[model samples]
Target chain A: MVRFEDISTPARLAEPGEGIGRDELSLATRNHGLPLEALRYDLTPPGLHYVLTHYDIPYAEDGDWELTLGGHVERPLRLDMDELRSYAAVTTRVTMECAGNGRALLSPRPVSQPWLVEAVGTADWTGVPLRALLAEAGVRDGAVDAVFTGADHGIERGVEQDYQRALPIETATGDAPEILVAYAMNGAPLPPQHGRPLRLVVPGWYGMAHVKWLRDITVAAESFTGFQQATAYRLRQEPDEPGEPVARIAPRALMVPPGFPDFMSRARVVRPGDHTLEGRAWSGHAPVTAVDVSTDDGHTWNPAALEASDDHRWAWRRWHFTWTAAIGTRVLCARATDAEGRTQPLEQPWNRGGFANNLVQRVPVHCTGL
Target chain B: MVRFEDISTPARLAEPGEGIGRDELSLATRNHGLPLEALRYDLTPPGLHYVLTHYDIPYAEDGDWELTLGGHVERPLRLDMDELRSYAAVTTRVTMECAGNGRALLSPRPVSQPWLVEAVGTADWTGVPLRALLAEAGVRDGAVDAVFTGADHGIERGVEQDYQRALPIETATGDAPEILVAYAMNGAPLPPQHGRPLRLVVPGWYGMAHVKWLRDITVAAESFTGFQQATAYRLRQEPDEPGEPVARIAPRALMVPPGFPDFMSRARVVRPGDHTLEGRAWSGHAPVTAVDVSTDDGHTWNPAALEASDDHRWAWRRWHFTWTAAIGTRVLCARATDAEGRTQPLEQPWNRGGFANNLVQRVPVHCTGL
Candidate 1:
């Protein structure tokens, strides 16, 4: 007997205190979440699709924001939006999710936003390759890390500071020209809500790696440890557990399971009969090679028809399963395995911050007798 | 040093299997998820907001869809959308979250939708009260529960069935008029994506209690043991643990801490200085009575001023605290207490399915030397 009231504490919204009013509270909620309804595709979700900015949106005036490349470089250089735009531009569809995308889903709720699955969205980012910008600065030897800084700064917790993060020198130059100092998204100038003027788009990495409102690039001999680097975005096992900073996304499969309304949290009313269950899959480490759909509660698994993706290393693929649903309750589960055989598990390894929770997704459905 | 590879399996999007081509994959991804930037908020996130339907959306013809009230009642009544609309209409604001809103946040993530915190949203639903309609149906004695049946159905896990949930006869009648068979949302007919024509909104309860595209109301002599009622949505300890079904929201306080976009996930660059921090707090058990602010990682706490709310039992209150910040890294934390003397814990008891994950939210900030 699962008593409904046994849930103990059934608080609804984190109600507003006297500090804010209904209107203000409304604004705050909107400011933080990219609605689930915005979800469209499984691949290339769309640039303006979803974003997780660390600070309030900063508006830049013409010639105001500048990207200054300094540190252990032979020729330190500073470039504005227009100047950076003059360089060769490349466009790529990248999937970006917040490092804390599942923070709220954690049992104890990690110290981050209470993000739902909606924290993810895909976008086509156009920008100057980071390697090119670094190359123009003539990087000197002994630089171990490339530190990226954003213009949005504020008091987080209690410390007043600027936002900064870092990537290893190898990663900065490896897929030369893939990491971007982007100025445009979806063929339009970067929206202020997104980092305008310039932002870093680390294809396949979590959103935090893509520093917004880019302003400085420091080629340092040591790793960078600013606000976001040293403390936030790290995947801890315990509260005090010193863990790795969250980065690239984990491979996972998401389908518009019959009744689910795209990315919205609301379930759709599914019907009894045969249905084409389909969705997109992607991976950062390796290409998605196989997808398995389980309609009988993982009892018997069947391989879903797969789609070959483009040559783009970061592009996603589509998969489908023809489900002859019966008149009853069902849990339609989808699982994917990358080329490296890194398959999604029934349960994701639990980390402190709930980062990259890419377990198999179980979508519940009910078919009417009618 | 947490290496980027430390994330172990850095897979990106759920890629398609080796079947379809890039073009087809593109079409599939676009088939779901709304574009992220399209999010708009009223009290609720909207029809496309945080809805989770059970079966394929059932289309009801103007003359076909009907609401039948029977079982244990004296005079069974049948009404169409038009007839139901003729009853006295009432409207109210309600914040609804999926019972599995924080599903993905769970450790060893549950076998369900990999939801983040965005699985919640508020809405103003207008409809005829359930009790009023029940009265017209004339409930007879010996009725212990009202089993609400939705037209949606399907196979869940392995069980074939329709979607049905029950409400104690008392609650159905006690919260008279508040529980409505809603037809209009934000002043429009319910969108098909959101249970077109008819749906139930049980205020203060999780989204599961709000049946959508409703069809039948059966007054029963005992509790219902449907799949969702006895099996799914329950908080189990071990995999085989018989857990209770999750219900009601818990007491929670969340502030739009600096660095996080005012209402967006985009990081807001905060400057070094003293700033007033505020946000909303609420509890389903009782009204929020007090809130405490902690700046030094929970070392000390200070009382925050609370705003008195009118007698809207389900509404939340806003609260605020002031802090003088220095240029450095910091953590901002807020804990809330309800009028029942139930204060939030620094650590909430961990539960399966990650239900009621209402621990305090900590926001990090960084102040530069500048």
Candidate 2:
């Protein structure tokens, strides 16, 4: 079982040799009291790692399910779940992140759980390519978009609601094998919370587009504008003017930010000694090009090696570095850059809604001389 | 009631003069739906309109509330809903569109709602400037991003989910007075489906970032990353690759594609001798500089008279021109150019998800000999 106390790290890292605060330390240890496992690696403990679910887990008994492919096509066909699984199965490791991972830290803190980091996770997924199914169904030239609907229900305007969204046709049947009708997670049957029978594994989109309890798939020459498409999962504010009538913002193609922030900076301690620094680097768009560690605050820098990943496209690589200290207090920092040359900035520009927060992350660690 | 059937228009313009196949007619109708009141322009109309909600219409009596401002300020205070409503509210005609407006038309067809070209609507919104509230709250430096949270909720993996997102602080307290903490929509107390008590109105963004059930606000040096941030609203597909792992996609700023296909061409069955052709022209990132209408399809074109708006940033203007029709059948097309010298293209390159579909739209109408 995963014990929060055994693996709980303070939200803010403590300075070298400094005693951690009782409140902060205790707060860190309180497990929502759930049982979890710790799959330890050099980086993110496998047990404490994140998991993304597209559709509710479907048991084998729900076996006789069929996937219907119709609309703007020469031929339409219905394939059962068994028939789909019969195709060549492909497995890939991918890192999934919630779009609003850094929203809690925004000023005028918006009403949210205020996740203090740790909302992202990577996992190996196994599924059948959607392209195979589309080809089997004989998609036609005029096909424009595909719609995916899920079984989960929620209250909207006091009425029970089912979550649904769509993707353009190009993404639905693209040559890229990223689109999946996934059936397994981390090599195991999907958890109940995660979509089980069959879920779309769209690697590079916000979680909203990855529907849970997926029930239906439709291909058409037009796009779908259900509640999720037209009303929800959108950016309400304009880029230039914060206070304007809510306009629908487009889904930005995901790309890593320009720079990585120094999450270990501003650390102080009651006790001081040689200190080792650590942090994590990830991007939804590109692989980590390099990670640089700095000690003397910002004056000097050293390179940190990144851990290898099974799939370079799906997981974040962790980095660590050690620093020698002989004085009272010193600031520690680390910065990461992606292969695309985007790096974290010292500070991100202020926006009304904090959709993307890849600013230099600084943690205060107080150190005392030993 | 809001009756969907009443709002729909007859299929007069779509059908070819001769008998057309049901499949063809369906395809044409799906690709293009005419506005009920094509000529009656008043921004957003009641029947054929768009609605954005905040927190499921705060429970009427309980909805009477106030906005409180505190933290790192000279004075902590509360602005009651009534008193806040007393502030001068300004109205501006603006066009609001879902970022996924034309997503269905994309090749491969992404997994999204089948939005039938009617996801866009224009309306004159009335709201008090957010700047006034910021001034009253006495915002201090170091404020990075403003977070907005709404009352909307759904159960995801047994977790009670609240819709929330954030924006840059500069956008929240920017020079433009376009940012509004809206209390009314189209001269009416916001409908329950629309944030009744209060909601943040931002122009030019997708609808998701606007929190529906706004409640509390907090200021911070950093930003927040909840489920919505980390998962729900991000892109996971690699933008650079035609098809890469979805996880390889990074969340970037939203982009609005310019120009609509065949936007300048329209046909009217007036006297069979001479008729006027017209269409709307606008851009999300820049203002429309000129519009060219073509009656002979794309063979030749004439400049159309462009209407002007007081604030061209938020609204799109209408343009029209006259043309002679020679009975039988003729193809009409329209194209537009923006201030940045970007002209409408015949087609757009296919992307995996089809987030930006600004290809020139084509509508073919048949005129019988009168």
| Deviation in Å, model 2, residue B359 alpha carbon | 2.4
TM-score of 2: 0.40
Of candidate 1 chain A, the 10-residue stretch with the lowest lDDT total is A2-11
**CA RMSD, predictions in order:** 14.2, 24.6
Number of the top-ranking candidate, with TM-score as the measure: 1
| Per-residue lDDT over A214-250 for candidate 2, one digit per residue giving the tens place of the 0 to 100 score | 6677787776767556543444344343232111111
Docking class of 1: incorrect
True contacts kept of each: 0.03, 0.00
Q: Estimate each model's TM-score.
A: 0.52, 0.40
